[model samples]
Target: MADIKPYTIAIDEERLNDLKTRLSLAKFPDELDEAGWDMGSPLADVKRFVKYWQESYDWRKAEAELNSVPHFVTDIQCDGFEPLAIHFIHVRSKVKGAIPLLFMHGWPGHFQEVLKVLKPLTEDGDGVNYPAFDIVAPSLPNFGFSEGPKKRGFASEQYAETMNKLMLKLGYKEYVTQGGDWGCHISRALAHLYPQYCKATHLNFNSANPPSYFTNPILALQHAILPYTSREQRGVGRSKWFDEQGRGYNSEQCTKPQTLGYALADSPVALLAWIYEKLHDWTDSYPWTEEEVCTWISIYWFSTAGPAASVRIYYETTQNVDGRKNKLDHQGLRAWSPGVKLGFSHFPMDIQVQPSTWVRTLGNVVFEKEHESGGHFATWERPDDIITDVREMFGKGGGAFGVVKDATGYAS
Candidate 1:
């Protein structure tokens, strides 16, 4: 606890003036009259947001709202990498045996995603019927207020190390995880690498390959025997659409993040458009206000490591750097991670909406739920969906019940 200290959101006055100057002098690009969202974030929407952001948005109000939550910062030094200052939100339930839950966020999303569900998750629950959790949501390295690793080859392994160590530092010897996007990847890596410490996981983004006969024979047999349900067929179509059309950002970030970083770092409009596009496209049409958009973009604009630092996670994990490949590859994450209890929540409009059969192949899937609606950012879009699933999964009679040693997630 000596190494961890209380944290607050404090963007400098100079930075606020700088952002205003950039917005005032921003340039706009010509758009196709009827393009809509087919090409990218519409020019009209961008211009409107720009005008609102420059004139009416209040950073001080937004900053105060964010600081209302309990936050802390600590130094975490991964093997062979310099110590980086990690920022996290920590909320401890009054319930003595409440489960420890580590909530992670992915690219284009910050630790703020936990805000909606924070109260419900950490509140006291009935001893025998409902459950409570001690929530720890951290801004991953190179994201939000957290410092980024300066050295190369800091991939999934380093991330898992950072998260695992964070939990251990908090005295959570055993815990479960919930995440989407890069959070999904990092949580899977935690299960794969530190099964003893990470007892279970509940993921919203179910990105996995089909079960192969050689690897998962039971799942493979089921995959072959079952007919594709209409929902699964639609999900597959969605997956294909993402692969063929929605992955231009992936390609660019994985190959040349530095080149793109220039645009994102220099121009506030460019950063807004780049992230705002995903916020629009990835959600289940969640109604977004201009103030909400500005606050979301402002976190990245005024991040400790800067907006440009975040994208390197994609490049570092996918491509070999400094003559060393990532310790935990993406394909390895898709494979079965034994001994770790697994749960998944499938949202129809998610970026890669895979079949339940495909997701089950990843681990010992003790629980699964399919939602009628929701998208990539389930935490923000449908907090109730995640809250229900987590309570059901770890509550009494659930498959993963009591997975975390004596932590039954209820009052003593």
Candidate 2:
């Protein structure tokens, strides 16, 4: 096991100046008459953001705030692959016997997603009868301060291996997990591959396909016979709209991420527009401040790995999308993994939100919550709800109570 080292966020002056230069020289595109979201992110919105990013947003101040958070790094190696220097924020609870919790972030997200829950999840609860956790939220390879692979074929399996090994290296022989988007996919992979160590999981995004008769006859039948809930019906519509109108990025990234990477890497405007669209569309009408948006994008601009490295996971995972050969069977990750307790939070505005029957088929569901609002970035947008779902699933009388042996994370 590699020795763990302290880590901090600091972008040099040259890079900061280059970002400003790029922002100043960015070209503005034409917009259609009153073209709103349907035409992708609006030109007007992009212009407003670019002006703020160049003139008003303070990158130095944002850096100090992010640096205020404690971070650490250690090398994790998977068999056959090279070792990777993984970056993470490790916050321990004041309460002894705190449950070890692994938090993972997905695309268009980084370790920053943990900011909202870092305190509540790790602090000793005041009078509230709930368990505290020792939280480990990593910047998955290529996404944040972490390093990325130059070689190809580092898919979900590799990601799971990286996270699982990190926990073991940190002396967490057993742990639970929480995630959304790619976080959901990676946690599912962890539960499937390392059920012995990863005891349970709570996820926010919809990740499973409808159960099939071959594998899940009972669930498949129930899926066929039962009437969809009003929420489920609305979810179907939301999913359909995303499929038709919002999946352009998915197709492009899955096939030609390298080509797209240039635009993201070289042009600040391009990168901002690309990610800003999702931030707007994927949320539940949450008002985003100018500084918040800039800081979010700035992480990518000044990431340890260049902005381009962040998008390669898309291409690597879906290289066989053309069906020439086998691709990463993402659907396989969603299949039931026994001995692993499962929990899910259904955020109404999340991309690809699924019906209960579909999500329930994912695994041994111990708890679930269907929220009236929230979206893909649920950890940031609805931290309390996500933490509560996890707490309820692992607390006393909860389905996964006493799962981690002597570590129940409660006051004696």
- Give the alpha-carbon lDDT of every model: 0.90, 0.85
User: lDDT by residue for model 1 over 1-412, one digit each (tens)?
Assistant: 6778999989999999999999999999998779888699999999999999999999999999999999999999999999999999998888766889999999999999999999998885864568889999999999999999999889998999999998888888899999999999999999888999999999999879998889888888998999887768889888888898799999999999999999999999999999999999888889999989999999999999999999999998888743553457788778789999999998988999888889988889999988889999999999999999999999999988888885533211
In the order shown, the candidates' Cα RMSDs to the true structure are 2.2, 3.0
State the local distance difference test value for candidate 1.
Answer: 0.90
| Shift in Å, residue 118, candidate 1 | 0.3
Off by over 4 Å in 2: 126-129, 320-328, 406-412
Best by TM-score: 1
- How many clashes in each candidate? 0, 0
lDDT of 1 at 267: 98
TM per prediction: 0.97, 0.95
Q: Where is the poorest 10-residue window by lDDT in model 2?
A: 320-329
On the 0 to 100 scale, the lDDT of residue 150 in model 1 is: 91
lDDT of 2 at 392: 85
